[model samples]
Target chain A: MKFSISRSQFIKTLNDVQRAIASKATIPILTGLKIAVSETGVTLTGSDADISIEATITQSDEKAQLLIEEPGNIVLPARFFGEIVKRLPEDQMTLTVGEGFQTTITSGTSSFNLNGLDANGYPHLPEIDAENKLTLPADILKQIISQTVIAVSNQESRPILTGVHILVKDNQLLAVATDSHRLSQRKLEINNGQGLEYDVIIPGKSLTELSKIITDDLEEVDLRITENQVLFTAGPIKFYSRLLEGNYPDTDRLIPHDATTTIEFNTQKLLASVERASLLSHASQNNVVRLVLDPEAKEGTIYSNSPELGNVQESLAFENLTGEKLDISFNPDYMKDALRSFGPTDIKVAFTSALRPFTLVPSEDEENFIQLITPVRTF
Target chain B: MKFSISRSQFIKTLNDVQRAIASKATIPILTGLKIAVSETGVTLTGSDADISIEATITQSDEKAQLLIEEPGNIVLPARFFGEIVKRLPEDQMTLTVGEGFQTTITSGTSSFNLNGLDANGYPHLPEIDAENKLTLPADILKQIISQTVIAVSNQESRPILTGVHILVKDNQLLAVATDSHRLSQRKLEINNGQGLEYDVIIPGKSLTELSKIITDDLEEVDLRITENQVLFTAGPIKFYSRLLEGNYPDTDRLIPHDATTTIEFNTQKLLASVERASLLSHASQNNVVRLVLDPEAKEGTIYSNSPELGNVQESLAFENLTGEKLDISFNPDYMKDALRSFGPTDIKVAFTSALRPFTLVPSEDEENFIQLITPVRTF
Candidate 1:
């Protein structure tokens, strides 16, 4: 393949696809990024077994300056070639492939000869029909991923739990993720809903990478779901991820509908207080902090103590406190995560008891997200 | 013990000493930070085996509004307590030790009861006489550390090579560090040297921590050396480091005096070119880059190649290339390090041959500092 393209434009496209480049060299060819030049434009593809990303640079209305001299395909080492092209000073870079799959890339006074593999050796990207596709704003997808992805389990013991379960009905989309210790559920309503309901589980890490590539500029993202693969396409970038093949657990039963006490507190203030308490508790354990609500005194106190270190107790102000007084302890990290996911300035925490899971959500609206944490038995 | 002080003041002092706190709990007591309160001031001390830092908050300081009701001492878990105090919201914090070494830390509505150890259990700071002392500008000391510390060997096989050798003779102070493959030597002359001549080896890690604590704005730092300990005192912070007890290797012989060729180049441009070349060579068995000076062409070229990956060649414009035309290959990482340590805008690189070590120094001032990197045989 022979082509010359703008350095920034190429770098941006390469970065989008580079995330899917295989970190583990199980298949040596998988570590290379496949580049193809056609009459339309240049396409870059990178993939591991689980996730694959393909980004295209087209001479479209965006006014991208690209010259296509020959139509062909080749695969070059992803990391090395990417770095070399990025460091080249020229605004436009030229790439040409010759006999024995040798590729020469030149920019200004810098030139690189890279050993390329035959593009035929690389695995083909799974093709997905656009019939069963959903469209949503990129910002909404990014928010859904950020709000719930952190709750996904990193361990592969229960492979399904490592993925975020997405459920859609009518115009509402629900994303839920849990590691048994903590759970996060986010809900969003999109206008362009296909009058169909579907459920799919996509790996949490895949969603994270997809979110990074989607900027916050309110771009439309088309999501296509096939039997075994899911495709997210935005602009000229198309991302394909292998779907988790299993039944997601019924997380509806885990969220409590009733609570003995509910209190409204300032989000930032409570978060800072919890962070301070965590510092002390983190010494003894993985940083567990306790919260005690005294309805009679109309006060909420956060306490954290390390037997070998020291203890901290802080009283937090609450807008409203009702129901029986309660004292509960849980991992501060879990609470911190829950607090961070909260959107509004004020958050309402509903507690069942000291030993049960508690829900934290925005005080004004329940449409954004809800985070639940299981309290630890500090006593 | 009872005292109330500004949270910011306490946090600042804690941060100053926290760097010396032991990360690993090999010695249980070493993980604790000792806090001693007296009528004059409050002192915080943290130490690992390699380095110890003591920072004082004097009652007389305008910024510190300390109320010392009782004088006492206690040791609290270093990392945890430091985090807790830093996160506390109140401007003023109070500390009180009740019966049975139960330390209570309170700020605003937050209070912490941390289990503290007897101050007597904490290791005492080494006592070093100030008789044999060398005073130098803190900025100079910091510059010396930054220039040579990276070359120190991390391996414990040659214990002396893990430290930076500091030699003081008359009014000249010389610092040298090497990991056998590469050596960096820097020298500075001071007026008030007191005619004292001494050689001491300070661990590179200790010096790094000291460098962080010493502000560049400070006029001078008092360096006192004892039998086994070295002390650096500037302003309210006192840093003590254990000296390595081995003779450093003679590095003077390794620096080549006569060179076959010398070239002057812009430091930043050379650094950027080397960095780009390094991206390709870093993946190879020998991370080497070759610089070929062509006097007739009035240009220089930097080349790096990895047989399994690819090869990169870039032309660099040299301000002046004299002596014999040369082509030398060396580890790109060492060259990058040497270039980064170049304090001047223009650097002169003197090469003896393709195998011998070359020296890199300021193009204008050769007396300030010099860094030497040994060439690697690419064949």
Candidate 2:
């Protein structure tokens, strides 16, 4: 294959697909990125067995300035090839595949000859059903992914908890992720559900990568789910992730309905206070911070202590406080993540005794999005 | 000590002193920063036994807004205190030392009570010969530090090679550093010699830290040398470093005066080509790139390859080439560091033979600064 294209435009697509290529894949061929050139366009594919990303550049693309001399395919070492393209001397670069898949990249007076693997040896991508695709605004999908992924379990003990449980029914899309200790749920109203219902557990990591690729330039992202694979398409980029097997835990019953005390605070203010309190708690063994709220006294205080480092106490800033007095101890990192996901909005936090789980929801939209955290039994 | 100061102003000085504070200090007190508050100003000192940095914030400084309520001293954990000050909620923060060395730092409604040590336990800074002082432009000093420190040996096998040999004599200041494989030498002309001569070896790590603190705001830095210490005073910041107690090797004889071949190229262009060749060389075991210069053909080419990956060859751009044909191989990493130290200028490279060391110097002024690298004997 021989093609000359705008280096900057090619680099953009290269970066997008390079995200899926792992540095050390068990299958050595998967470590390389597949490049297929045709009369109409060029397609770049990268895979790590579990996740695969494909980006296409067409001759019709004005910015790409693609000039195809021949049609063929080659798989080059993803990282090294990327580095070479980035450091090319000119605005444009030409890539050609020669005898025995020996590819040469030439830009200005510099040329890089690399041994390429046969693209035919690459594993075939899963065939997604286009008719079952569900489309959503890129912004909303990105927000949902960011909010829920934080609660996904990083541990491999419970494999299902590593994914976000996505459910679509009655024209409402719900996304939930939990690590047993904390849970996050976001609800998005769908206008074009088309009377279709589907339930799937998508790996949180996949959603994170998908959210990143859904840049501001992208208006919408289309999702198609097969039995074991899910595909999300944004513009010319197609992202495919293998669905996690087995049923996700029912987290609907995990959120608390009743609360003994409730306090409203600006997310930014509480985040700062929690971050400060965490300094000492992180230095300590248990990594727990305590929050004391008194209804009659109308006071709130956050405290944390490290045996070797000392202690910290701050008068927590709150907009509103009501109901019974309560004292709770929990992981400050979880609280920081939940507060950050709320952005700069005012959030109301509800507590159900010292050991029970507490929920934090945006004050204006309490029913749509919620973050629940289970308190530590530090008696 | 009790003082209320602008958090930003305090943080600047805190960061400067924190550079001297090591995380795992041999002396426990050296791990902490000593804050000595007087009616006139507040002094923050941090030391790691070998290097000690002290920054003074005066009450007259408007930006500091330092309000000295009392005169006393206390030592606080350098890193922890810096982190606390950075995350404080208000522009102004008050730090007060109470009974039993307990320190309370309050800003807005957030308060951090930290365990403080007795300031008297902190190690005393080295006393230098203030009368015999040499002042130089901060920019020039920073440049000299940056140029030579790159060649300093990181391995502690020969501890003296880890420092830059500095000699001041005959109205000229010369600095040189080498790891045996590559050497960098820089010389600065001094206007006032004062008929005094001195030679010292300052640790590269100390100079690196000192260079960072010499920001653009500072005009000049005063150097005071003692029996075994070198102190650099930049405005209110005093950086004290213990001198290496050994004689430096004579590097003047190591430079070759004659050359069989020579080539000149823009520093930036040559650096780019070297960087590209390094990509493939880095993947290989020996990590070497080859340079072929043929005077008859007026051609210069750079090549590097990996047994497992492949190879890269580039037609080198040069302004002039003369004398004899040569083929040399050397570690690209050493060449990269030498080229970067030259900044952006046309450089003349002189080679004696394929196995001999080559010298690179600025084309405009060849006498003041020179970088030499020993070529690898590739069979």
Candidate 3:
């Protein structure tokens, strides 16, 4: 493969593809990135079995500054190639692959010859049906991923729980993630026909990588879901990820129906108070922080005590504190995460009792997002 | 200790002392900071086995914003105290100690109650005689430490080599460090009389911490060297570090007397080329890069080849290449370090032969600094 490309353009594409290159892959060749140059353009691919990323630059893309002299293919070690390209002395770099897959990269007075593996050895990307396809704005998709991805189960014992369950009906798209301790769910409006519905469980790890590729500025991404695989196309980049096989658990019933106690406060103020209280609770084994509300006094306090370290208490005034005097304890980290996922505004926190789960929702009705956390039994 | 100190001032003092607090110390009290409150001001002390730092804030100083309610002393856990002071909700924080050393820190609506150890249990700072004293600018001392400290031996086999050997003669202060593979020596002129000389070896780890405390704005630090310890007093902060006991190695003999080949080049240009070559060499086990100079062509080339990764070659036009043609191999990391130690200007890279060690010196005559790296034998 012989091609001369602009350094800046090549760098952007290389970074997107390198994200899928596993640090340690079961198959050694999977650790490399495949580079194929044709008379028309160039293509780069990286895969780690579960997710694959392919970026393409065509000769028609004058901004990419690509000119293909020969048509060939080779796979180079992803990390070494990336590092070398980043340090090239000039703005333009020319790549040439010789016999036996010896690739040479030249720019200015510097030239790097990297050993390349046979591209034929790399596994081909699986084909997915495009019958069920939907186009959504990249910004909304990124928001959905960030809001729910953090709540996915980190343990491997329950494989299905490690993915975010995404559902697309008539004109609505919903994403939900729960690790048994906490749950995050978000819904958005989609422009899709009523004749089709899509349900897929995408691994949280894959969504994180996808979010990085789908930057906020990008306008839209075309998504296609098949039986066992899903393909996402953002501009000239194609991202493919494997779908989880098992059925996702029904989490609708897990969310509490009615609230016994409700309190409204500034999101940032409550977050800061809980963070200070967590200073001591984090040192404790249970990582629990108690929330005490006084109806008559019209005040609320966050308290945490560690036998060996000490104790911390913070009082935050709430707009509306009503219901029977309530005291509850839960993992402070979960609450911090839930607060961070919302915009800086007032949030309504509802609790059923001290031992049951609690839910937090933004006060504004425009954003359909909810976070639930199961309280810890402190007494 | 009881004081309503400025949150910002308290944070700065706490950070300086916390550097000396060991994460896990042999003596439990060493993990806490000794805070003494007086009618005039407050003093905070933190110490590990090797080093101790004391920062004092007096009421007379307008910048500290300190108010002493009572006079007392108590030791609080360094890490916890530092965190609380940093996150106080208000500009002013009031710390009050009650019976049994129960300390309460209150600010705005936030309160933290920490268990404090008795001040009597904390170890005392060793007494050091001030018979030999010299005052030097903090900027120069920080420079001397940065230039030589990187070469200090990290291995414990030679305990003395782990510290930088400092020799203060009639009017010059010399600092040197080496780990057998490379040596760095730097000297600065001090305004000392021809009466007495000072010699001591301070641990590299301690110097690293001291560098953080010596900000650029500070003017001078009083240096006092005793038999077993050295004390540095910068403004209201006093830093004491234990000196290493064993005799330093005779590194004077390691520097080459004459150079057979002397090549001068721009420091930044050469550094950039070698950094690229290190991309592949660093991936290899030995991290070796070859330097080939051609006197006839008045140019130099850096080359590195890995059997599995391929090769990299970079050529640069030298300012002046004289003497016989030469080629040598050495660890690129050591060369990078030696080059970085020099000021950004033309540096003279001198070599005797392929087997002998080489030296790097500044092309200018103002600063007296030399770095030597033993070349690796590739044959």
Clashing pairs in 2: none
Go through the candidates in order and give each one's C-alpha lDDT.
0.87, 0.94, 0.90
The reply for model 2, stretches above 4 Å from the true place, is none
Model 3 docking tier (incorrect/acceptable/medium/high): high
For model 2 chain A, the run of ten residues with the poorest summed lDDT: A125-134
Tens-digit per-residue lDDT, B226-292, candidate 3:
8999999988899999999989999999998888899887888888898999998988888899999
Ranking by TM-score: 2, 3, 1
Give lDDT tens digits, candidate 1, residues A1-379.
7989899889888998899996568999999999999987999999987889888888772555899999999999898788887888778899999999999999888888998999999987897976867898887788789889889999999999999999888888899999999999988886777685779999999998888889866488998888888999887788899999989999999999999999998888888888887776766755678788988889888887767565677889788899999988899888878787775479888999999999988877865688999888866
List, residue by residue over B1-379, the lDDT tens digit for candidate 1. Answer: 9999998878878998999997676778889899999988899999997788999998898788998989999988788778777777889989999998888888888888888889998888898866867888888888899999989999998889999999999798889999999999988887888888879999999999999988856888999998789999978999999999978888888888888888898888888889989987888887889989877767799999888878889999678788787788989898888888884489888898888888888988887778888888766
- The CAPRI class of candidate 1 is medium
TM-score of chain B of each: 0.97, 0.99, 0.97
- Give the share of true interchain contacts found in each model: 0.94, 0.77, 0.86
Candidate 1: residue A114 lDDT (0-100): 90
Model 1 interface Cα RMSD in Å: 1.4
lDDT of 2 by residue, A283-360 (tens): 999999999999889999999999888899999889679999998899999999999999999999999889899999
Which candidate do you rate higher for TM-score, 1 or 2?
2
